[model samples]
Target: MSYQDRRSPDPLRRRRRTTPRQRALLELLKRDNHFRSAQQWHAELRTTVGVGLTSVYRILHQFAEQHVVETQRAEDGELLYRLRDTAEHYHNLLCRICGRAERFTLDALEHHTEHVARQYRYADVNHHLDLYGTCPDCAGVAQQE
Candidate 1:
């Protein structure tokens, strides 16, 4: 099927236009909090949805462009993807090994950002916080080896 044909025909639909495969992928990501690679997503999807790897990669890139998901680079330089949180702003501590993430909010950081922006007379400022490191579980496992 062609890309244009995958879009919703209904003009009244309020949500962003997405293909059936894209919707399925979003649902899967909604249930999983950890970042996962396109290969992993495609592997899981194949068991039920039978989507092609190219389709998975295309849909993931589209989702990322639409701000429906976030992307990060792993230590090995592979790209990882996960659904974005609904909160206005937050930080994520990502595990380098497992792609697990811990979400956090800090008032001081927000205040500091605002203070700095105001000092510099900046307007329409935005930020994305993603701190990457080994989570405690991964750290423990590494220490054991």
Candidate 2:
């Protein structure tokens, strides 16, 4: 049999019973560029997708558990979620002034982490790095003054 035929059907797909709220949440995440908090998502869903706040939160948690989405703490300490599939890699650059976030590849950062791990004789080491700086807009404003 072909690979498609040999593989079992997706459980969620087979049910034809997936929640509309969950689908709507996925759709919203797919369209947005930045990560958003549960409250922000709920507001957007209510205005655009007609989904309720409770349903949005429930679906977000489900998505987070499945690794379909990722959560991060914003500068103000609010939890935000973004679709994982759309992210090429996961490293953050934080703007000190405006508190905006930018995601970039982690190649150089990973290399440094590996070097540190080897120096420390670590069996395995994983690290998260967030670089903080004034973003271009903020830097430009600073320069103008």
Off-target runs (Cα >4 Å) in candidate 2 are 1-17, 48-52, 86-88, 94-101, 132-145
Error at 121, model 1, angstroms: 1.6
Candidate 2 residue-pair clash tally: 0
Assess every candidate by TM-score: 0.68, 0.64
Q: What is the model-wide C-alpha lDDT for candidate 2? A: 0.66
| Clash count of each predicted structure | 0, 0
- Which lDDT values do the candidates have, in the order given? 0.73, 0.66
How many residue pairs clash in model 1?
0
Which stretches of model 1 miss by more than 4 angstroms?
1-13, 16-18, 73-78, 140-145
Error (Å) of candidate 1 at residue 110 is 1.7
